[model samples]
Target: MANPDFEDLVETFEFLDDWEDRYRHVIDMGKAMPPLEEALKVPATKVDGCASQVWLVPKIADNVFTFRGESDAMIVRGLIAVLSALYNDQPVSDVMKIDAAAELGRLGLNDHLSAQRSNGLRAMVERIRETAAAAA
Candidate 1:
Protein backbone atom coordinates (compact mmCIF):
# COMPACT_ATOMS: atom_id res chain seq x y z
CA MET A 1 0.00 0.00 0.00
CA ALA A 2 1.13 3.54 -0.66
CA ASN A 3 2.13 5.47 2.41
CA PRO A 4 0.03 8.45 3.29
CA ASP A 5 1.83 11.79 3.23
CA PHE A 6 1.43 14.40 5.96
CA GLU A 7 -0.83 16.34 3.66
CA ASP A 8 -2.82 13.21 2.95
CA LEU A 9 -3.41 12.56 6.66
CA VAL A 10 -4.43 16.18 7.17
CA GLU A 11 -6.74 16.04 4.23
CA THR A 12 -8.22 12.83 5.58
CA PHE A 13 -8.93 14.49 8.90
CA GLU A 14 -10.52 17.45 7.17
CA PHE A 15 -12.65 15.24 4.97
CA LEU A 16 -13.84 13.10 7.84
CA ASP A 17 -15.53 16.00 9.66
CA ASP A 18 -15.71 14.16 13.00
CA TRP A 19 -13.40 12.59 15.56
CA GLU A 20 -15.22 9.25 15.33
CA ASP A 21 -14.65 8.99 11.63
CA ARG A 22 -11.05 10.03 12.05
CA TYR A 23 -10.55 7.31 14.66
CA ARG A 24 -12.11 4.73 12.36
CA HIS A 25 -9.76 5.77 9.62
CA VAL A 26 -6.84 5.39 11.97
CA ILE A 27 -7.98 1.88 12.94
CA ASP A 28 -8.33 1.01 9.30
CA MET A 29 -4.80 2.14 8.62
CA GLY A 30 -3.56 -0.03 11.46
CA LYS A 31 -5.35 -3.02 10.01
CA ALA A 32 -3.32 -2.61 6.85
CA MET A 33 0.06 -3.19 8.57
CA PRO A 34 1.68 -6.50 7.78
CA PRO A 35 2.00 -8.84 10.75
CA LEU A 36 5.22 -8.64 12.74
CA GLU A 37 7.44 -11.61 12.17
CA GLU A 38 7.93 -14.01 15.08
CA ALA A 39 11.70 -13.57 15.02
CA LEU A 40 11.37 -9.82 15.50
CA LYS A 41 9.09 -10.21 18.47
CA VAL A 42 11.16 -9.56 21.55
CA PRO A 43 11.19 -7.34 24.62
CA ALA A 44 14.14 -5.38 23.28
CA THR A 45 12.12 -4.31 20.27
CA LYS A 46 9.15 -3.23 22.36
CA VAL A 47 8.40 0.47 22.70
CA ASP A 48 8.27 1.86 26.24
CA GLY A 49 5.66 4.16 27.79
CA CYS A 50 2.88 3.13 25.47
CA ALA A 51 -0.54 2.20 26.80
CA SER A 52 -0.63 -0.62 24.28
CA GLN A 53 1.93 -3.21 23.36
CA VAL A 54 4.06 -1.83 20.49
CA TRP A 55 7.11 -3.28 18.84
CA LEU A 56 9.37 -1.72 16.21
CA VAL A 57 12.02 -3.30 14.07
CA PRO A 58 14.25 -1.49 11.60
CA LYS A 59 16.12 -3.00 8.70
CA ILE A 60 18.17 -1.76 5.78
CA ALA A 61 17.48 -3.05 2.31
CA ASP A 62 18.95 -1.72 -0.92
CA ASN A 63 20.45 1.16 1.14
CA VAL A 64 17.06 2.38 2.34
CA PHE A 65 15.80 2.04 5.90
CA THR A 66 12.47 0.35 6.44
CA PHE A 67 10.62 -0.10 9.72
CA ARG A 68 8.18 -2.77 10.77
CA GLY A 69 5.96 -2.26 13.77
CA GLU A 70 3.04 -3.95 15.50
CA SER A 71 0.64 -3.30 18.36
CA ASP A 72 -1.81 -5.49 20.14
CA ALA A 73 -4.34 -2.69 20.27
CA MET A 74 -5.95 -1.57 17.05
CA ILE A 75 -5.54 2.12 17.87
CA VAL A 76 -1.87 1.71 18.66
CA ARG A 77 -1.43 -0.32 15.50
CA GLY A 78 -2.97 2.57 13.64
CA LEU A 79 -0.54 4.87 15.37
CA ILE A 80 2.28 2.69 14.12
CA ALA A 81 0.85 2.88 10.62
CA VAL A 82 0.94 6.66 10.80
CA LEU A 83 4.57 6.60 11.89
CA SER A 84 5.44 4.06 9.25
CA ALA A 85 3.87 6.19 6.57
CA LEU A 86 6.27 8.99 7.43
CA TYR A 87 9.46 7.15 8.32
CA ASN A 88 9.49 3.86 6.48
CA ASP A 89 11.49 3.55 3.23
CA GLN A 90 13.60 6.57 4.20
CA PRO A 91 17.25 6.62 5.12
CA VAL A 92 18.18 6.31 8.79
CA SER A 93 19.36 9.90 8.89
CA ASP A 94 16.14 11.12 7.38
CA VAL A 95 14.08 9.16 9.89
CA MET A 96 16.12 10.56 12.77
CA LYS A 97 15.84 14.08 11.37
CA ILE A 98 12.07 14.03 11.29
CA ASP A 99 10.27 16.13 13.91
CA ALA A 100 7.48 13.68 14.57
CA ALA A 101 5.55 15.85 17.02
CA ALA A 102 5.43 18.81 14.69
CA GLU A 103 4.57 16.63 11.75
CA LEU A 104 1.72 15.03 13.69
CA GLY A 105 0.49 18.49 14.59
CA ARG A 106 0.50 19.51 10.96
CA LEU A 107 -1.42 16.35 10.25
CA GLY A 108 -3.95 17.39 12.94
CA LEU A 109 -3.10 14.32 15.01
CA ASN A 110 -1.28 15.91 17.92
CA ASP A 111 -4.23 18.04 18.94
CA HIS A 112 -6.60 15.12 19.01
CA LEU A 113 -4.52 12.75 21.14
CA SER A 114 -4.73 12.46 24.89
CA ALA A 115 -1.66 13.51 26.88
CA GLN A 116 -0.68 9.94 27.67
CA ARG A 117 -1.19 8.81 24.11
CA SER A 118 0.87 11.73 22.85
CA ASN A 119 3.68 10.86 25.23
CA GLY A 120 3.49 7.25 24.13
CA LEU A 121 3.71 8.34 20.54
CA ARG A 122 6.78 10.42 21.30
CA ALA A 123 8.38 7.46 23.07
CA MET A 124 7.65 5.29 20.06
CA VAL A 125 9.34 7.77 17.75
CA GLU A 126 12.35 8.03 20.04
CA ARG A 127 12.68 4.27 20.16
CA ILE A 128 12.57 4.14 16.37
CA ARG A 129 15.27 6.78 16.12
CA GLU A 130 17.47 4.98 18.61
CA THR A 131 17.13 1.82 16.58
CA ALA A 132 17.99 3.66 13.40
CA ALA A 133 21.02 5.28 14.99
CA ALA A 134 22.28 1.93 16.18
CA ALA A 135 21.79 0.48 12.72
CA ALA A 136 23.60 3.40 11.13
Candidate 2:
Protein backbone atom coordinates (compact mmCIF):
# COMPACT_ATOMS: atom_id res chain seq x y z
CA MET A 1 0.00 0.00 0.00
CA ALA A 2 1.06 3.57 -0.63
CA ASN A 3 2.22 5.67 2.27
CA PRO A 4 -0.27 8.22 3.56
CA ASP A 5 0.15 11.77 2.33
CA PHE A 6 2.04 14.00 4.79
CA GLU A 7 -0.51 16.77 4.62
CA ASP A 8 -3.32 14.32 5.24
CA LEU A 9 -1.51 12.95 8.27
CA VAL A 10 -1.04 16.44 9.65
CA GLU A 11 -4.70 17.21 9.09
CA THR A 12 -5.72 13.99 10.81
CA PHE A 13 -3.61 14.88 13.81
CA GLU A 14 -5.12 18.35 13.81
CA PHE A 15 -8.56 16.87 14.14
CA LEU A 16 -7.54 15.37 17.46
CA ASP A 17 -7.50 18.37 19.80
CA ASP A 18 -6.18 16.40 22.72
CA TRP A 19 -2.68 14.92 22.87
CA GLU A 20 -4.06 11.60 24.09
CA ASP A 21 -6.33 11.32 21.10
CA ARG A 22 -3.53 12.30 18.77
CA TYR A 23 -1.29 9.66 20.28
CA ARG A 24 -3.94 7.02 19.76
CA HIS A 25 -4.20 8.14 16.18
CA VAL A 26 -0.49 7.73 15.81
CA ILE A 27 -0.52 4.26 17.32
CA ASP A 28 -3.38 3.32 15.06
CA MET A 29 -1.37 4.42 12.07
CA GLY A 30 1.41 2.13 13.18
CA LYS A 31 -0.98 -0.78 13.51
CA ALA A 32 -2.20 -0.08 10.03
CA MET A 33 1.22 -0.75 8.53
CA PRO A 34 1.76 -4.05 6.78
CA PRO A 35 4.30 -6.35 8.33
CA LEU A 36 7.80 -6.33 6.89
CA GLU A 37 8.90 -9.45 5.06
CA GLU A 38 11.09 -11.85 7.05
CA ALA A 39 13.83 -11.79 4.43
CA LEU A 40 14.31 -8.03 4.85
CA LYS A 41 14.80 -8.23 8.61
CA VAL A 42 18.51 -8.25 9.33
CA PRO A 43 21.03 -6.93 11.86
CA ALA A 44 22.51 -4.36 9.50
CA THR A 45 19.05 -2.97 8.74
CA LYS A 46 18.13 -2.62 12.39
CA VAL A 47 17.97 0.85 13.94
CA ASP A 48 20.14 1.02 17.04
CA GLY A 49 19.56 3.07 20.23
CA CYS A 50 15.80 2.85 20.04
CA ALA A 51 13.88 2.24 23.26
CA SER A 52 11.92 -0.30 21.27
CA GLN A 53 13.17 -2.56 18.51
CA VAL A 54 13.14 -0.92 15.09
CA TRP A 55 14.38 -2.13 11.74
CA LEU A 56 14.77 0.02 8.66
CA VAL A 57 15.52 -1.10 5.14
CA PRO A 58 16.27 1.34 2.34
CA LYS A 59 15.71 0.71 -1.35
CA ILE A 60 16.88 2.94 -4.16
CA ALA A 61 15.05 2.79 -7.47
CA ASP A 62 15.27 5.42 -10.18
CA ASN A 63 17.38 7.47 -7.79
CA VAL A 64 14.56 7.55 -5.20
CA PHE A 65 14.91 6.01 -1.79
CA THR A 66 11.98 4.06 -0.40
CA PHE A 67 12.09 2.90 3.19
CA ARG A 68 10.46 -0.10 4.86
CA GLY A 69 10.44 -0.17 8.64
CA GLU A 70 9.07 -2.13 11.59
CA SER A 71 8.96 -1.65 15.36
CA ASP A 72 7.99 -3.74 18.32
CA ALA A 73 6.31 -0.95 20.26
CA MET A 74 2.99 0.35 19.03
CA ILE A 75 3.98 3.95 19.58
CA VAL A 76 7.29 3.44 17.86
CA ARG A 77 5.49 1.77 14.98
CA GLY A 78 3.32 4.86 14.69
CA LEU A 79 6.46 6.96 14.71
CA ILE A 80 7.75 4.84 11.85
CA ALA A 81 4.57 5.55 9.92
CA VAL A 82 5.23 9.25 10.26
CA LEU A 83 8.79 8.78 9.11
CA SER A 84 7.70 6.57 6.25
CA ALA A 85 5.31 9.22 5.02
CA LEU A 86 8.16 11.70 4.96
CA TYR A 87 10.96 9.53 3.60
CA ASN A 88 9.39 6.65 1.69
CA ASP A 89 9.51 6.62 -2.09
CA GLN A 90 11.61 9.78 -2.20
CA PRO A 91 15.02 10.29 -3.69
CA VAL A 92 17.98 10.00 -1.33
CA SER A 93 18.81 13.66 -1.90
CA ASP A 94 15.21 14.63 -1.30
CA VAL A 95 15.04 12.66 1.93
CA MET A 96 18.27 14.32 3.04
CA LYS A 97 16.86 17.71 2.08
CA ILE A 98 13.97 17.41 4.55
CA ASP A 99 14.30 19.07 7.92
CA ALA A 100 12.53 16.33 9.91
CA ALA A 101 12.58 18.18 13.22
CA ALA A 102 10.91 21.20 11.71
CA GLU A 103 8.47 19.08 9.79
CA LEU A 104 7.50 17.18 12.95
CA GLY A 105 6.97 20.50 14.68
CA ARG A 106 4.68 21.60 11.88
CA LEU A 107 2.81 18.38 12.38
CA GLY A 108 2.54 19.26 16.10
CA LEU A 109 4.43 16.14 17.15
CA ASN A 110 7.86 17.35 18.24
CA ASP A 111 6.81 19.12 21.44
CA HIS A 112 4.51 16.31 22.49
CA LEU A 113 7.21 13.63 22.44
CA SER A 114 9.40 12.68 25.39
CA ALA A 115 13.14 13.24 25.17
CA GLN A 116 13.87 9.54 24.78
CA ARG A 117 11.32 9.10 22.02
CA SER A 118 12.68 12.19 20.32
CA ASN A 119 16.19 10.81 20.50
CA GLY A 120 15.06 7.53 19.02
CA LEU A 121 13.36 9.38 16.19
CA ARG A 122 16.53 11.32 15.54
CA ALA A 123 18.56 8.13 15.52
CA MET A 124 16.20 6.55 13.02
CA VAL A 125 16.46 9.56 10.70
CA GLU A 126 20.23 9.65 11.02
CA ARG A 127 20.41 5.98 10.15
CA ILE A 128 18.33 6.57 7.05
CA ARG A 129 20.59 9.44 6.05
CA GLU A 130 23.66 7.34 6.58
CA THR A 131 22.17 4.63 4.41
CA ALA A 132 21.41 7.15 1.71
CA ALA A 133 24.90 8.64 1.90
CA ALA A 134 26.46 5.22 1.55
CA ALA A 135 24.27 4.47 -1.46
CA ALA A 136 25.20 7.81 -3.04
TM-score of 1: 0.87
| Residue clash pairs of candidate 2 | none
lDDT of 1 by residue, 15-126 (tens): 8978889989999999998999888889988888998888998788775778889989898899998888778888766776777777777667777888888888999888
Expressed as tens digits, the lDDT of each residue in 42-132 for candidate 2 is: 8988888898889998889888888888998999999999988878887677777778887788777887888889889999989988888
Candidate 1: residue pairs that collide: none
State, as a TM-score between 0 and 1, how close model 2 is to the true structure.
Answer: 0.91
TM-score of each: 0.87, 0.91
Pick the TM-score winner: 2
